[model samples]
Structure formats: structure tokens, C-alpha cells
Target: MSARHAASPGRRDEGRAQPAGGGDGEYTTYYGRPVVKAPPWEVDIPAYMFAGGLAAGSSLLAAGGDLTGRPALRRAGRLTAAGALGFSMVALIHDLGRPERFLNMLRTMKLTSPMSVGTWILSLYGGPAGLAAASEVARWAGLRRGPFRLLAALDRPAGVAAGLTAPPVAAYTAVLLADTATPSWHESYRELPFVFCGSAAAAAGGAAMILAPADQAGPARRLAVGGAVAEVAAEQRMERSMGLTAEPLHHGKAGKLMTAAKYLTAGGAALSLLAGRSRVAAVTAGAALLAGSACTRLGIFEAGIASAEDPKYTVVPQRERLRRGQPVRYEG
Candidate 1:
């Protein structure tokens, strides 16, 4: 037998017979070879994630600003929240196969589908945030004196609404990814929420420092530090728990992106301590953290897609289960 033919199961010397097709024929399995295809959805999924993180973080920063009586930070936070929400809406709609049917997503609630839950959350949260942001702008334009008074009255209510939704906004994106067929994302579901929370916090903090006066940036800096620490801890725990499945974190482009994120997060947190005393340091560190968050988001999205593309991730575990006499359940 030729070297290629010798590698086939038909080449065994113990009463093995070649198939009728002969040596030149292509080998075929009972089922077709596995094919990996990207989801038909646009790349806007990651952008939506980024926007959601920004909105959540901005809301949290706004609350922090309110608690500390930092007007500048509060104003910046509110504006950021509005802008993020706007971008989120745009990205989500852009991702829809039938954009007009987007609203129908709210027709039912299925805990099994994170997208449904996220839709509801966004709907509820976006209303108040949008109102609050608009009111802030109106107030700035001195339109609070006329027919716009009702909108001004909505400011506090909107603020309250945003505050309540902030944490979930950060967390639900993780659930969104987890509910998908991606193994890397689903396996890291427990850690993904915390990672997003940190990214949001860092991004919001950076935006606040960039916009607000130095004194008003203090609370944002603290939030950034807290978020960075939480994110690092969560990532470490995820890596430890996933074992060989977590190989994506240490390989190729994903590894480089994650590495950059970690360094930026850590360095930014360290710099935040002295940011209050140095405006330049505060702006520089905040920018770094924001960039880091973007890298982390992109890396996570890529990793999840990679995991879904590899047939081994889907098959090996099932074979192992079969070897142990366990009934395999096909999820997809």
C-alpha cells in the first residue's frame, strides 16, 4: 500500500479488505465533515457589548458622583450613559436579521435565552437613561422654564432607574454570550459577568476623568481600581477552573489581546491612586484602562468564536462520555 493508503484503517494486515472505491478514492464518513461557519449576525454584537458596558459603567459612576456630591462627574456620567445607550440601540438593530422584528423579541420571556432577558432589560433601562440624559441637556439650555418642565421633573426618576439597572446591564451581556453555542463563553459564564463589570467601571472612570475636573474625578478613579481588581480575580478563577479548555487564553491573537488588557488594567489601577494629585496621570491612566477594556472585549468575542469553530471541542467530550457508558445529550 502507498504511504497514504497505509495510514487508512483498510490497510490493516489482519483480513482487512479495501473498499471497492480503491486507493485513489476520497475517504468519506457516514456523516459529512464538520463545517465551521460564522453566525450570520453582523459584527455589531461586540459593539453592542461595548456599548452596554459603557452604559452600565456610566450609570454606576453617576451614582457614585451623586453620593459624593461631585456635580461635574455626575454630569459627565449622565452624558456618557446616554451616548452609550444610543450606540447600544444602533448596534443591536444593526445585528437583527429583520430589524423591524426587533421589538417582537419582547413578546415572551425565556430564561434559557439571554437575548430575550437582555431585550427586556435594555428596554426598561434605556427609557429612564434616555430621559435623564435629555433632561440634563435641556437643563443646560435653560429650557427647564417652559413646556420642557415635565422632562426636567423626570431627571430624578430617570437617575433612579439607571442606578437600579446598572449592575444587571453589566452582567446580562455575559449571559447573552453564555446562552449561545460558544463553549468558551458558556464555560466562563460565571466569570464573564464580573469581567464585564470591571471593564465597564474602568471605561466609565476613564471617561469621567477625561471630562470632569481633577477633584471630581476622585470617585471615578476609586471605582476603576475596584473594578480592575475584581476583573483580575475573576479572570484568574476562570482560567484555573477551565483547565485545558482555557487554552485560548494562552494562544495566538487572543493571548496577546488578553495580555495587553491585563497589563493596562493593572497599570491603570496603580496609577489611579496618584491620579488625584496629577491631572496628566489621571487622563493617561484612564485612557489606557478604556483601551484595555476594548481589547478584552474583542479578545473574548474572538475566543468564543474560536471555541465554536473547533470540532474537537464539540466531539471529544462526547466521545469521552460514550466511553464511560453515559448517554450523550445533543444540545444544539
Candidate 2:
């Protein structure tokens, strides 16, 4: 959304009731205004999304490691989960413009609202992840006496609780994005959750792989490979099924970011397959996967904003659907 994002005022140039938002020479709009206004989000929203997913995945990894007696993996996963969740909260609060706005959201529990559900999801996931991470810190600081002993003893339970809520934490943002009026994002309702989950898993695994011992990083490597595969597949299917709405994802700055995400994810997954013996390979693969996840989130966020700013994406797709005798409902 660079040059194309700017919509200068212009009069209707077509004789038809609605201008040809398609590839015709004529076009129409409310003085070149977008059919649907873009979501008033900035870089913070994408950062929030990426960090939330990473936290969820890391919490799950922590639970797995704790259950399986992998101390290094568990500690690393818990620490990363806690750190990522803190970052996610910061981004969310910054986007909301006031910390109290986020606090006010906790007052209501609207089942049908993604914003409500996502807020509750974050709140619920945070407690357990924080406790688990805190327990690890307590152990490291030799605070296993008095009340600190109780905290350290509850590590497994806290980790398991975090894991229980991880899937929703990883996926709710996709639901929230798709529920919006943005043409590209709304059309991608079906596959976005899978993409988000996959990205989260890859990021968490990659980070843990880089931090944990090579011997205990087997699960992280596997998770990274599996996640990269799922992400690539879901994204491909989503694009293929989106018809006209997929245009934004394949053109301009959004397209370039997505291309980079694809290469990084693929390369990371490939390297992870052979990383079991070499710590250096594991670290490199982990870095690629982390970068890929960031790119994927950023690309999708930019694409949605771009599509929302373009009347062509909004009008042409609905018109095409109507021409095909399909039901088309205006969301706004």
C-alpha cells in the first residue's frame, strides 16, 4: 500500500449507474473514495498479532517439554512465551490508544464479537503463561523456599493451563481480521486461522530451537517443519480460492513481503530437517522461520489495508459474483 494507497478526489467518469470498477476504461466512486474504508490500524496491530501467536505456540511447547521432562526446552519455551505475551500486550494497548480502553473491554463478554472474545482469550492465556515463566525464574534465582516453593511447584499445572488456551490465542486474531469488512481479509475467512496457527507454531519452535540444546530441540525442529508446511499450504489454498480478492496479495509491497515469507519459511523448514546434529544449522533455521512468520503477518496486514483502500477490490468481486448468479451482500 504505497502509491496505490493514495486516493485523490475525482468525479465519476462513467455514464452507468455504477462505474466499471473492473478493467473498463470508465470508473466511478464518491470522488475516488474507497468503497470500504480501511481499518484504522498501523504497524502495532501486526506486531500484536505476531507476538500473540508466538506466545501461544511457546506456551504449548513449554507444556509439552514440562510433561516430557525436557528442562531446557521447557525453560526456554516458558521464557519466550512470557516475553512475547508482554510485547503483544504492549502493542495492543498502543493500538487502542489508551491502556484503560483495553481494561474497559474486559467489562463485557460478547460471544459474537471477535474483539470481545480475543480480549478474553488474551487475558485468560496470560495468567498461566506468566505463572509458568515466573516459576522458571524463581528456580533459577534459588527462590524455592517459603511461598516461592508453592509457585515453583505449580509450574507444570501453569504450563498445562497455558497450553490448554494456546489454540484459541493463536487463532482468534485471524477470526477477528476476517470478521471485518475488508474485501481481501473477509474473503479469506476459511484459511486464515490455519495460516495464523502455522505461523505461530513455526515461530515458537524456531525460537526454542535456537535457545534449547540441540538434543532437546527435536520437537522444535519437527514443529517448525510441520508449521511451515501448513502455513505454505493454507496460504496457497486461500489465494487460489479467493478469486478477485487475491489480487492484493499478489501485487505491490504486500506481494513482495509474502514472497520473502515463502522463501524464508521453505528454507527454514528444509534446514530444520538436517539440523539435529548441528547447533549452527538449528540456529540458522530458527532465525529464518522467525523472520518468515513476521513477514507473513506483515504481508497479510498490508494486503488487507490495501484491499480496503481500493474500490476495485470491493466492487469488482461482488459484481463478478452477482454475474455468476451468486448471492452478494454488502457488508457496510
Most TM-score-accurate candidate = 2
List candidate 2 stretches off by more than 4 Å: 1-23, 324-326
User: lDDT, candidate 1, residue 74?
Assistant: 78
Q: Which candidate is the best by lDDT?
A: 2
Per-residue error for 39 in candidate 2, Å, reads 0.5
lDDT of each: 0.75, 0.88
lDDT string, candidate 1, 1-332, tens digits: 12122122333332222222545343321222222233555458877887888888898788667667887887899999999889888888878856676789888887777788888888888888888788878878889676689998877778778878888888898888776655677668777888888888888887787788887888888888888888888888987765545777767778888899999989888888888889888888888888788888887887777765554454444446678998744443
Deviating ranges (above 4 Å) for candidate 1: 1-38, 319-328
TM-score of each: 0.85, 0.93
Poorest lDDT segment (10 consecutive residues) of candidate 1: 1-10
- Of candidate 2, the 10-residue stretch with the lowest lDDT total is 8-17
* lDDT tens readout by residue for model 2, 1-332: 22232232332322212444434433445456676778899999999999999999999899999888899999999999999999999999999999999999999999999999999999999999999999999999989889998997887899999999999999999999999989999999999999999999999999999999988888899999999999999999999988888988988999999999999999999999878988889999999999999999999999999898777777678668778999865544
At residue 5, candidate 1 shows an lDDT of 21
